[model samples]
Target: MVSQTSHVYRYRVDAEDTIVAVDEWWLAFAKENNSLDLDEASVVGKSLWSFIADHATQKLYKEIHRFVRVTGNPITVPFRCDSPTLRRYMQLTITRHDKQHLDYESVLLRAVPSRRLALLDPIQQRSAAFLTMCSFCKRSLIEPSGWLEIENIAIKLRLYREQTVPEIRYTVCPDCEDHFGSNRQKLESSSEQPPR
Candidate 1:
């Protein structure tokens, strides 16, 4: 039986490198946070790389597995994944095994979202002209007052409402900074809460 550990993903693989089982908590995390659509039972015959969408990450997984399989040595590495929607820092721990019941490699991954990364994805892509916008409200508090219109920013970027691209960036517009700047306690509390 697999034990439950928050933020950790535990799974076993057969000698053939097929995923045989997944832990309960890992399934919950996959459903709630993973962008990949995977079923607890259905994931079993598939290659672990099949569920990973990022090209760079996929390559990383391949290299790591190849090394372990060839050398029969255990390895542990920490890496980060950043996309338009989510950013995570994860530790990949791989161990080689030859147990009677499960004779193969097993991976125990523990990941945490980067405190520096936003929890939510951007509504749309930024225009060619980059703009500093509010994270909570998704608006530009640029000079001359009020939030900038999506259309105008689009024009500057030479993009259309139909073509805005989502990307990752860090900012806290003056409006928010000013409003909550003095109220550190309120700002901290509110920031911890997901945006409405």
Candidate 2:
């Protein structure tokens, strides 16, 4: 079980996506959630986007962030991403605001549930079955959050607690599959280009 982290990832980053300020409490949170071996020094001044390790998560964030930057609006969503040190879940709240006094336009990111907590789902089925999971990220299909960690499948599906891990059938997740199709098209188009 991961220790509940102290800091809640409430930080402000510039429009350029560079973190300009951070909370000291988050330092303690980083200590607890230390997955990617990051510290205060590593976080501040770094591109907020650099922290994401999951391709699917990165892709999703890119789209969401693009819209926020363009629209200057706020958004809140439950996003699962592998943190610096572990695979964890977080509730992300992003807001667009400008500090008139400082002449700064940036985004505020507030993260909740600083640790990876087990998800309990009420299930009527006791029998285990093959589950579809993401081929790349390994996040299984789970309720509420859609795709989550494979550990969650057993809990959500109510599989045998004493039994070994259930079998997982690999398939590209929807988001990644979409990106995969787009990437393949780009690759094909580039391949058709005359070698120049």
How many pairs of residues collide in each model?
3, 4
- State residue 106's C-alpha deviation in candidate 2, in Å: 16
lDDT of 2 at 163: 33
* RMSD, one per candidate, in order: 16.1, 11.2
Model 1, span 78-98: residue lDDT tens = 433332233344455676555
Native-referenced Cα lDDT, model 2: 0.51
TM-scores, all models, native as reference: 0.45, 0.47
Candidate 1 wrongly placed segments (more than 4 Å): 1-7, 34-36, 53-56, 81-87, 99-196
lDDT of 2 by residue, 130-195 (tens): 566674455777656798765555456654343334454555587656644543444334434442
For this target, which candidate reaches the highest lDDT against the unseen true structure? 2
Task: Name the top TM-score candidate.
Answer: 2
> Model 2 has how many clashing residue pairs?
4
The collision pairs in model 2 are 35-84, 35-85, 36-84, 36-85
**Least well predicted 10-residue stretch by lDDT in candidate 2:** 99-108
* Error at 121, model 2, angstroms: 23
